[model samples]
Target: MNSEFSYRLLPGLLPYYAFRVCTKFLQSQDLILPGVIIGFLANGFNIFSNWLFIFQFELGVNGAPWATSLTRAIQFIFMILYLLWRKDSLADTWPSFSLRKLSYNVVKPFLTLAFSGMFSFAAEAWSFEVTTILAGLLGTIALDSHTITLNIATFIYLSFPFAVGIATSIKVGQLIGEGKAADARRSAIVAYGVNFAVQITLIAIVWPCSRLIASLFSKDEEIVDLVASLIPLSCIFMLGDAVQANTGGALRGLGRQKLVLLLNILGFWLLAVPFGAVLAFATNIGVRGLWWGFTVGLYSAAFIGILFLVFRVNWEKEAFKAQRRIAQTSQ
Candidate 1:
């Protein structure tokens, strides 16, 4: 088994994983910063609250797990309270206690979320997962270097998606709400522009310091060697990453979850994973092969995601009209 298996698994990991997944809901609704503070504080509180278990019983590393769980629980609780208090922002527009309403309110949003939010995460995660697997097959130093590059790329990527989500969520929601087709189109363009500007700035900052950042993860000569060789690829990878995420956000705003899901599966599973596996194991391409796969898949997803957004405009309008008809019938 992998060294990190227990890190991703274990009963204690669930709450934190759930918090990460559910936080997107808050983000799409514009509550992330406050939620993060509450989450961090909750974690701090959990450590304090569970200090008795650590000190009195000496549970060792296990006590840390309990502390993490307590944090997630408290974070979830706070989020629930916040949502309930801000009922207008969080509530379903039409109310009913029936199963049908539940399906519409919770199930649909969740299904959309699974594809748009979770599936996208899965695509990105699998890219890293496969990298880890491939690196393991190669050697430990290769694995260390791969992990280093992946972490830096991830940190750099965190900026674009949140900004993209802001534009996509608010503008698309408003456009759909008011039947403004031109505005919907403009919003997508605007999101892309914003993502482009921000991502370019990040690339400029990191590209020159790429080796410096990579060196931070490890001091081993072999690991550092691998990282230095991969820095350029990592920079390219970041651009593709930005495009993929922001385009996915645009689709999410357009409510095209199925399309987004299909695009991700095709891009990552069909194209990236298989090719990377072949090059990483069957050939002598090494760690860079894994990143090459990442670049290909991300670029493919970005292109396809953009195409999906373009085609989805009419469908989005139709969805709005259909909802309007339902409302008219009820009236």
Candidate 2:
């Protein structure tokens, strides 16, 4: 079983890498609609493929991940088709493939941003992986419940907030590069508003349909019940996730990813995980306690990003710095 799982994982990464390449290119170009359309299409394809593989072919247990991998590959393929059909947009950017002059002076700043961005994102993601480990300590049922609830939350998150955050990043960077500080700040506000509204709508749906939602993932009564119970907590955490995603987008645009990095580590590791460990082991709260702890981390961690963007930042000064970066990069 272990060897089979590992083998399947190898195939999974290929589609994931392809999806990343296409979506990242689209986002970098500020072409939000193409990426969003591709995402919805991929998810729809995933559903169809899963049904085909699992029930139609009797592939059973391994069908879902395989379906997912196929969908990811399809997404990139669809993207390539879109680019080919819409020759004008790609043509504008791909007029020629050229990597302008390279130097340590030119490369160092980008390397700094890349490392900081990578670590900041990795820390939060790894912290969540630790929660999965902690849930396993409670036994199979708890782990199953945690996995289902997380999958649901992730689906909702990626559906909207993720896209909004990317748009926020691209828009802010563009406005700042143009030396329009106030407009960049306004763009940040609009992004926050959109994310907040979308998340609230999702929470309202999830809170009432918790059981129905849980049933979609599993049939076992215990797992379904546990997931329903966890769904509310997931909604609570969703609040934090929305805030963090939105503000983090702006921070990434601002090039303050190191600050984002420190806050996530402190919030998730120091505050959330420890609190959850104590609650889960010391009290009768059990697996739900772990989620409560994550909730704390999400809200607390996101607040710092808010503070930096709202209270601390000088908009005009930021614009000047962005202009300077642009000038340097262009040179």
Candidate 3:
């Protein structure tokens, strides 16, 4: 009952959620540096709030949600104040809302994009969560090693290709808005090429230093060995992961969002999870089998995405679609 009540505090975070959407919209409009700065500050505030509530206040486990809600509320207020100070059109226009304008211009497209994008994100995330659950079922050592390895991989992902992918999405969309279909395609190609080169270099660096990296996270020899063994598989997984991530971003910019969402559903849910389950339980390979399944799904998604970009996409048509969408919403 206490936990449920604590969880109820999540509703207080709606403002932060709105703020994030606003930030992303700004970033999509090419205001990248401001958005990045604000996001960094917000994250720092969240961390500080967590430390204050959990350590200084001695609030225990429930401190986490309180810290999150408080930090979000503060961040939301900060964003609103900044917008007001700038006399931003978004703030100025908020009071002039009308049902007819919203229905035709915002709500229709918003719902269509939101549902598809939400499912795509959820499908990929849930597959990894399920993989974690399966790892826990393997044993304590397996779960610990898996957790540490996953953390390292996630850190690397967020550091480079993910950032590049987001920038690529925004840039592509901007180019499309200008009706430069060829330039948009070129941008995507360059983004994908750069991501590939960077990922390959990192893989080479990681392969030689796998044991050294694993040692940083664990003092246990068995855990270190397990993590080291997983690094090679992680390299393969990272390559596919980076490719699919970049491609998915490009697809979003091209306005083929429904297709992107479908691909994620097919790749992660229909393919990765069941295959990983079979390999983990039916074979003697254990936890590594789960990661192997992950590699397969990512590779499949990347291949399909790349193929679509190369052979199937009509850049001219996509540019026009982007133009129409932008024009509609701006009104």
Candidate 4:
């Protein structure tokens, strides 16, 4: 499974990158619904392919990534087709390519921001990936619980808070572009209102029906028991995640990815992963140790993040800087 998971992940990387690029471009254009619909189609196909390859074909572990790769490829193709269909609408942004446009001065700032944003996301993501690896080391039962809980948390993050974050970033960017820093600040507040709304809704679903939720993922009684035990921790983890996502989104709108990268490193690496590893390996607390460690780090980071947004950030100044940068770039 190790070798298979490793190599299998490779085939999907390029397609996933392509899909992400297309989706982001669409998002920036305020064409999010297209990407969402395409994503749904791809995921729907992925589920069917997983069933076909894993169950009907009886290929087991080997079949899963193949299904994923195919789905990713389909998604990229669909996104490309969507762009082609909208060629006329995108023409202004897709001016003819020119060799003289490829200067370092033009690309450097973009690359810096892009890379900072990339690493900011990767830092948090990799911590969970690390947890998954550690779970594998603990044994099959532990891995099962970790996998199910992680998936549930990820699903909720992506479906709700993450979406709110993206919308907040877009709204803030629009407000800043219009030189309305006060409006952007208000938009951020509105986003938090939405974020907590969804979080409450999520807690309602995950708390009382935890065992039922676990059973949805796995039928084995032992796995169900273990996953249910992790749900309370996951609920707490989601709150921190929601706050982090909200703060992170606002910073991105301010073009402050460097600060975001710093925070993620301080939280996930300096705090979460190391502490979780110690709790998991140095103690008898087992998988829950890692879970608690992550919760602590996330909550700590989120607290600091919210504080920074409230006290440190100067929205009017950020908007002025952004307008200056835009004016300079246009020249």
Which candidate tops lDDT?
A: 4
Clash-forming residue pairs, model 4 = none
lDDT of each: 0.70, 0.85, 0.84, 0.88
Question: Whose TM-score is greatest here?
Answer: 3
Instruction: Give residue 249's lDDT in candidate 3 (0 to 100).
Output: 90
All models, RMSD in angstroms: 4.2, 2.9, 2.7, 2.5
Model 4 lDDT tens row, 136-252: 899999999999999999999998999899888888877887789999999999999889988989898788999999999899998999999999889988998898889889889
Give the per-residue lDDT of model 3 (tens digit) for 1-331.
5875468478556977888876786676676666567668878988998899889999876777888888778777777776666666555344365676666667778788778888888888888899999999999999998888888888879888888888788888889889999999999999999999999999999988999999999999999999999988988899888898899899888766788898998788878888888898899988998888888888898899999999998899888988888788877
lDDT of 1: 0.70
Per-candidate clash tally: 0, 0, 0, 0
The TM-scores of all predictions, comma-separated, are 0.78, 0.86, 0.90, 0.89
lDDT of 2 at 315: 85
Question: Candidate 1's residue-wise lDDT over 1-331, tens digit each?
Answer: 3434345235546666666655656665556676668766886797685785567668655566556666677777676676667778667542347655554545655565565656766775776786688788788888888888877777777646555655575566556656776777777788778777888888788878766876787777778778878877888877877777767766666666666777788778887777777777777878788878877877888887777667645755645763674465344
What is the lDDT for 132 in model 3? 95
Instruction: Give the Å error, residue 123, model 2.
Output: 1.4
- Local lDDT at 30 for model 2: 74
Order candidates by TM-score, high to low: 3, 4, 2, 1
